[model samples]
Target chain A: MATFSFAVMAVLPLFLMIFIGYFLRVFHVFKESFFNEVTRFCFKVAMPCLIFKNIYSSNLDVGSYVPLVVFGITGIISLAVIGCLFIPLTVKDQKKKGVMVQNLFRANFFFFGIPMITNIFGEEHIGPAVMMVAFVVPIFNILGAVVLAFFQEHEGKKRVDFKDILHNIFTNPIIIGAIIAFLFVLLKIPLFDFVVDVIGDIADVTTTIALISLGGTFKFQSAKHNMPYIIRGVLDKLFLVPAIMLTIAVILGFRGPELAICLALFGAPGAVASFVMAKEAGADGELAGQLIVFTTAFAFVSLVFFIFILRSLGFI
Target chain B: MASSFSFAFGAVLPIFMLVGLGYILRRLGYFPEAFVTLINKFCFEVALPALVFYNIYTSNTTIGQNSGLLIFGALAICGIAAVSLLILPKLVKESPRRAVLAQNMFRSNFILFGIPMAANMYGNDGVGPASILLAISAILYNILGTAIMAYYQEKQRSGKKSVHIVPLLKSIFKNHIIIGAALALVLLSLQIQLPNFLDRTVSDVAKVATPMGLMAVGAHFNFARAKADFRYLMIGLSGKLLIAPAIVMIIAIFCGFRGPLLGALLGMTASPGSITSYVVATSMDADGDLAGELVVFGTALSAFTMFGFIFLLRSLGFL
Candidate 1:
């Protein structure tokens, strides 16, 4: 019962906070353009800091998890296969195929996954979770992009430039964060902690403002047109994918913090990456928006149900 | 519960404050163009790199039994993502926009969102491995991901493709962030530490980067444009935020990733489309608007898709 209440308390406030920002925007308590700016902040500043701090501070064994690494790479390969199988059955647009390939593996581990995992498992479980997120996400990005480009080439279209991939992966802020941190760890070089501490000190404002700003962008009316896509998206993301992940985790004997964090991560709502991908592919941005709204709305219930089941089974 | 509240509050409050304030200032017309440029440059060139460098300089390494696992684990994830791009297209009829959509669905936001969140969750321990994986991903993205994009464009034009090694090497060297990262690594390897004054200055500058960047983000909404390009965006969003992560998870399980590694792998699986994707799209002239929409849509949808993924992982005791 205590755990149940704890679960509610953990999730409710987060939802409430975002909703409050949303209502404040709706009521005109704040100016309308706030969300756009906040979203910008999240992209430009806060998130980068978050990545830097995480990568730098952790003490990790980059070589300990061969099995896990192999597993992750194989997982991406499977995503392509799954996407290929479905492509023929349902959709046909080449760009949409590219989009499908990307979304099949893009997970949100930062805000949603971290909080939920920390909430349920405490701080101890954070390290491995972070490692998995850092390593797997980027590989997913690069490989996913490559696969998309390959399909484009097969159609006799202009392919994604190999140079672009290299430039993007290596020079990217997050990837840089991962690399630099790893080197620092490997070399045993110690810097004055104040450097990051100062940044860390100011970090909280970035995400909060972004969330509030996102709230300001909320337009209930906008959701009307993209309902079908949103529904389908929710079905695929909030239901089917997670169900599949759970079956796999159970069969594989994952337990404790690993299980908890994985579940929390699986339950995370669609990331803003969907919108980015849609815009890049010249797909329906509105559909992406609808997915965000719809999935976020449903995630509350799904997460709660997840917690209940986990606690009942003594998993948490 | 209290701890969780405090943790969340700690994470979000500052963002709320800065963005909220920035919005007010923007509406007041207090932010000049020069100011915006300065802010962007500071965030991008100096502060951002410092943040990355500082973090890297502080981490601890794990190299024994864990080494093989990290390498193989990353390889597996990369392999899967590549395979997805291939397979997804086969399931659907090929079309002109397939390249863009496939890229959207397959790619992820590693640095912007994933790193920080990983930091907050795992601290230094997870950050170390995450960084290594990130490097591997970087190599893969540049070599494999970009190759695919280029191939598509070539095929669409003349159906003729050839490897252009010189251009690729030039581009690789020219990437600012990568260069910065490489420099930092070299410095770390050389055991060079910044002087206190320099360190303090860089750190101070870095400190301002996040809040300022966040403010800039707040001012960057394009609902009007997004609304104009709804359909194509939705397709991209669906592929990226939904299908992409689903496929990754299945593969991860089949490949036997479990425990914290599995959780982290899954965590990475659901990231939204990266801004880097936008950069690549623009450079290649493939569909920038579509890329932007994917970033937007992928980000928004992640809230729910992530939750569902978490729920499933929890039920299966893999959290």
Candidate 2:
């Protein structure tokens, strides 16, 4: 019962936001030109400040999770290997192959993941979550990029360039912010607490605004075309994968919060990485778009079940 | 502190309002065909880079030891994602478009929405790690991501095989966000202090970034296009909300990840598609509409998925 209410609490606002945005558009409260200016304003000035503020104020730690890092990486490698075995057999077209690689393995570690978890668990759980992100992002970049490149390249055509992958990873804005933030933390440099406080305040406001924008962007029309892919994606990401992961967690003797975090993440929607990979690999960009929509929509069901399952096992 | 419900609702309000306005204007036929292009250019070239530069430059967090481990971990996660990308297409026997849809389903939105949440949750420490991950992804988005787009375009054009390095590098360097971030890093490394006036000026300019961005995002929201692109949108929704997160869990567990790292990693693993994908698609002339659909659908669906993940984690004591 508590879980059900919680689910409603979580879902209601999202729906409202989308509905409101859509309705406003339908009603013509403002001009289209205004949105462009707003997008420009956020993207150029505000977002960068937010990124700078976060990194400049934080302290970095290098050896925080050596064992965890190693284990996490190894696991990804194994999955990739297993996944690769199925790819060639399942997808004969090189173009299609590129798309497949992105779908199954990519993880959504940013937008929804960070905000949702932080809101639920507070700062204490942040350290572990942060550490995990550090480990997971690069593998997605290089390996994901390689797969994308490989599939994107015409059959019997030019060889894939390793340098391109490195370049892509190095130049990214988000990645750059991550690097600077890491450095600040590592050096143990002191920043003005007041500056951080200001940034924090701004961050709070920005987060809400970003969410609103996100809501406004939702479109239901596309769901119709993406049914089959949606079903498959949902099964793989929400059910099959999480079930396997929970079993592993239970077997490993991880109890309490540790177990909970692992299980919840396991059942999360597909990563946004697939979207990026699809675009990069020259797959069906529209199809990739729809897949993200479908899986996320169904995540609530999987999550609720997981919570019940965990509660039943006394993992909480 | 704001509760999750309040926080999310509050965050999303402005964008929706703006989108509503944009929609009305379109219906009224007040704008020319080039309006979208103009809006997109402003958001893409100017606003985005500035936002990125400010974010990277102003960070005061310290870099810790074992940074390499974080990098490695990200790589490993990517490795897993690569495999998923490879395999999912086969399981479903999807077309190239469907295959890409499957992959996008799994990726995260690290930029606009992801990083700020990291800051809010863990303060500097969390943001620092997220930044590293984002950087790695940036690199991938440009060279590797671009290469793939080129490959597909070539295939469609007649199975051509040549990869262009110059254009890829040019795009990366020419990107305002990347340039701004680079500048910030250089300034920070040199420990350059801004003059009081300049600092104030910078802050003032930065202040407008978010609200303006939200407004722009709202204004750009296209319901009609989404309706037209429904098929692609479905694929994106499923892949992002379902398959991606599941894959992350399997990979994280298999790799033996636990604790907060597991949660944070998974949280990120569940993000919707990024706005940048749209930008990249536009720049490459690949499929910006698909990118936009992914961003919109993924963002929307993520709420449910994210909530479920959070609730499950809390129930199991992770939260």
TM-score of 1: 0.48
Q: Candidate 1 falls in which docking quality class? A: incorrect
Model 1 stretches astray by more than 4 angstroms: A29-33, A63-73, A92-102, A143-156, A204-207, A222-226, B1-319
Q: Tell me the tens digit of each residue's lDDT in model 2 across B51-150.
A: 5556556655444763653655466446645665676556544234533453364355665455655555556765666665665554444334444554
True contacts kept of each: 0.06, 0.00
Candidate 1 chain B, run of 10 with poorest lDDT: B1-10
Model 2 regions more than 4 Å off: A3-64, A91-94, A153-158, A222-226, A255-265, A271-273, B1-319
| Tens digits of per-residue lDDT for model 1, A212-307 | 455566666656654555566676767666667755765676666666555655566766766665665455555655566667777777777677
Using lDDT as the measure, the top candidate is 1
TM-score of chain A of each: 0.83, 0.78
